[model samples]
Target: MKNDTVGRLKMGYLPLAFVFLFFATELSSQVNIADPFVLRVDGKFYLYGTDDKKPNDGIPVLVSDDMVNWSGPAGNAAGKLALAKGSSYGTRGFWAPFVVQNNHMFYMYYTANEKIAVATSDSPLGPFMQQEFRPLNDSLKEIDPHVFIDDDGRKYIYFVRLINGNRTFAAELADDMRSLKPGTVVECINQSQPWEIISGNKWPVTEAPAILKHQGKYYLFYTANDFRSPAYNVGYAVSASPLGPFVKYKENPLIRQTDKIKGTGGCEFVTGPGEKLYMFYHAHADEQSPTPRRTLFSNAIFVPGKAAGESIFQVSENKVFLKSSAR
Candidate 1:
């Protein structure tokens, strides 16, 4: 909202619309992955997301060197998927994917048919397959899986459960990392902020959970409002423990709708080429619509909050547009 782009280009600044046009050619011509999640392993970045292009083919992945200029759905030639449908779980509705490496194996936690599942592969460019094809729990519909491991080696899975609305929850994971530790499931956050009410429906919503443990605090990042609305955006809560009474930031909607970017939610953080922290997110195809999303990258930094003794994360107004040649 502050328009840092203007100040950065003061010497030879083109009109904002023209600048958008220039970047549009570099971006719109390629990558269209929605609900994007990027994983950096061994100096290379692997991107996984809701495959709108091949919704029923399991999760699709792309490889990149600089977090821009992507190559391949990697192994998705001839309809092959990183996690193929038949080889894993769920029949349709493949969405939001987050991957983590543990015990020398890459585990991909993702959504399919509104359910959560984890698949494993030897390589980051995965032919990820499930050991057992089943949802984490079939009792209720759930989606958007994010796995976080504590410094003590405790594993937790954070996700959204469709109850009164889309509420965020977390549960300690079993040793196998395929199921939950019984009786550990706990509600993490609710749709309490005014900005979260953009859906204008009876059901309030808070989805897309990504957790970060920093300075002994658990930062629970989530997206609110219906993903379809341009008002959809991201916010975060903080707690002393992984599952807890988390407090939403006093100043929220960290990332929001800008003149050139809309529907700014569904994000994940990754350390990029220069060891700089970057947030990968998707905006609607254009300024006025919410379909055919395009991925965008922005630098993120930790900052002191308005409240005393509080720290928060901020995303830069600057952004990078890259083409996903594989798309």
Candidate 2:
């Protein structure tokens, strides 16, 4: 009789114990990761993000078996630096890294002090070495390097040119995967929509370039306005060609600040488990924080119908997508 009573007591405590452990693990594993990018390799999601939240760290990365749980080196992110600071290009300011694999090497296209550079590593988790310590072209005034290799085996790198009020441009990467093809560079998109105007945006800003090829159309997703401004939001443009004459979706901003989740922008799209398309983005920690720290969130993205144009892409739970996940 005593044994049966003890067993019941232990069973009752087990569920509470698990709930406590889950919260503890989540608090330790995930921190503020901004300008976030997630790459799925070997059935695992590897995350890389700007060094903004971490003090004195060059760049930080997180790893996860499932998208729900993430961790830095050794399962804590507070003091770890994945990419060291100080480079031939510039010492500081690394943001928005887009990583891809080719020829058994992982290539990270990232910004250093607002200049674009590349670093290579054998593994996704890297102390990536910068073999070519210079920007792609000393003449190309650009930042935010997002690399996309199309189904046809051709590669393209889309980047933001700060020259004309934060416009974006695309160029075909030469067969080597670093330098651009001589005459393939073209201006892709810029801010003209009304919602793009924000408080700190004196001129205009359309940055954070991410490309997706769907339904025989190239979709360019970008963020507008100052990231610090509450007006920051995500929008899309459609084009037939990778080097695009992209047309902005009539609805303009796709993801916007909700009463619950404010300042939603700077996102990347990746295929999650079950062939689902998910968007990983950063928003102010909650509605209360407003313009301060940014936290990473992932939500399902819906692309309806076979044809592409207008409201072809719909994001579920605009008011509470992040809230859907307990994390």
Candidate 3:
């Protein structure tokens, strides 16, 4: 059903209604987390997710400023544990953890027993130091590990492979942001639409990938089904470059599942202070249905018109309004 967003912003922009995410409450139970990953060092904003693996294979760090008050990743709160515990591929099963920063260092990309790794830190609150423990490609089944760096600076590395199931891949990274730059990998999107099937036609699904470039194109956001169904939301694809042939957005699932947040797909997109653009996700915190505990949300992503890089984005309307109040 190739999205319309009000007939493609009425042919050139002028439709703004939906704009959500202002969570601090609802589904309470002190918001346990899931697949979220965000980082913005100095101006302060660091959140990593999917923790609670019995006392410490570690991976839970929270600290927000106005992304609507997000403290408490557990116990002594103020949220800590930015990727600890040793690894040569063995230390529990930390699922997703993605961080990026260039020259001044700070480069963490995670996932353990299912492969995909990289760690190094100068700060972003980390004891992170896996120093190339290997697995960018060792046969498939990789994990979600995003890292996009473009605008003429080139450094891409979006992941998620599983042969015939969860597919989303990209390459081009070498400048020591930890290898990969041999043939430019590339295999962008998979899992054909129809609301991303679920049990038939090329089933399986996509994974969490987050790329955003605007104007010059290259928006790849992902997240399809079975992220504990409720139809795990979010979908996007478009590319002029950034290792792609991408093109899935006939008005696709650019974020869905609501009626009190039963699905919001693991997401990440950043930018702040005068640049704005925000989107951090995690929500399965059922108010009356699907539940498994996943709570950490945010919104605000715009691109209304006025031209610059060729405007056409509004995928930040999950609920579009929900005040703040959970702690």
Candidate 4:
């Protein structure tokens, strides 16, 4: 009878142990990756963004097997490439680069001196070669280039143009992804909105525009206020078309710094395995001295029923404990 009881107890404990092990694996899979840009190409994932250090002069790249733990700065595979001859702009350090692969060729869109440029590479970890120095509206001082390929085999580049005294504008790229198509500039939003407009500030500012298409509508996400100021925050606007007539979300400034946390801005969104949405950005370290030395943080973005749903860009509770896990 005692042997029978022991057998039953062992079976119960076996299932319990399995459950614990499964959760442990799932928890281990959740890693803290900063400035989180996730790109999946040919069955592999690549992440690119700014490192925690300020005035970061180099582009940092990370690769992951399962979109969890990342492997590197990809071992010196990226840097500035010479601008093509006769291209008169964008000859400087690379910053805030976003990479995409199409037709087995890799393209990197990056910002320098508030101008956006394009480079191409045969490999994802690239010694990318510069193809053009100025790829957007030559008249506009633009930055934070985000490229999207729509379902109709059409390509578009979405970026923020600081114009008309420091307001943000959005424009579309030509199909070739090399330059802005004529008459494609659409003034999506300006600092005129009561929430965007600030008192005693001569410059109305908005920048870092990222676009995602969801359920027949396009969502435009951006940041506003002076990045160096305490008021830095993230906001969103929506449109039925890629180039819009964007409607600012009633709840503008979706995420901002509170008394507890300081210096919150620079937003990018990525969808990971299991269709999970993640927001990647940099913030000031709460415990570290001299807050300018910010660190990267990631948190799950919750959206429901539509692609333009609300987002919360806060550091995950577990992320606070995650030491810099980069290898």
Which digits, one per residue and each the tens of the lDDT, describe model 2 over residues 1-327?
010111111111112332344455553433566777878887998778775554335667777665655655521222344566653344667778888888888888888767888887777777666765787867756788898887777889989998858888999999887789999989888888888887555768999998876656787889988876777889888888988899988787877555766678878866655545667787776766644345554444434555544327656442212111222
What's the count of clashing pairs in each model shown?
A: 1, 0, 9, 0
Give the distance in Å from residue 250's predicted Cα in candidate 4 to where it truly belongs.
0.9
Model 3: residues >4 Å from true position, as ranges? 1-27, 37-49, 52-93, 97-110, 117-169, 172-182, 186-209, 212-216, 220-239, 242-294, 299-302, 312-327
The C-alpha TM-scores of every prediction are: 0.89, 0.82, 0.31, 0.73
List runs of model 4 lying over 4 Å from the truth: 1-36, 42-44, 51-56, 66-68, 75-93, 131-139, 193-199, 256-260, 286-327
Candidate ordering by TM-score (highest first): 1, 2, 4, 3
- Which of 2 and 3 is the better model by TM-score? 2
Q: Whole-model lDDT, candidate 4? A: 0.55
Q: What is the lDDT of residue 171 in candidate 3?
A: 90
Q: Is 1 or 4 the stronger prediction by lDDT? A: 1
What is the C-alpha local distance difference test score of candidate 3?
0.65
- The residue-by-residue lDDT of candidate 4 on 262-281, one tens digit each, is 54666665554444444556
RMSD of each: 6.1, 10.6, 18.6, 11.0
Candidate 4: lDDT of 10? 11
* Candidate 1 lDDT by residue in tens digits, 1-327: 110111121121112542364466564356788899988777788888986667887787788776777887685423546787788888898899888888789888889889998888888777888767888888899999988877778888899999989999999999998989999999988988888886347878899998766656778889988887888899999999988779998789997457878888888877664455677888888877777788887777776667776667777777666576644
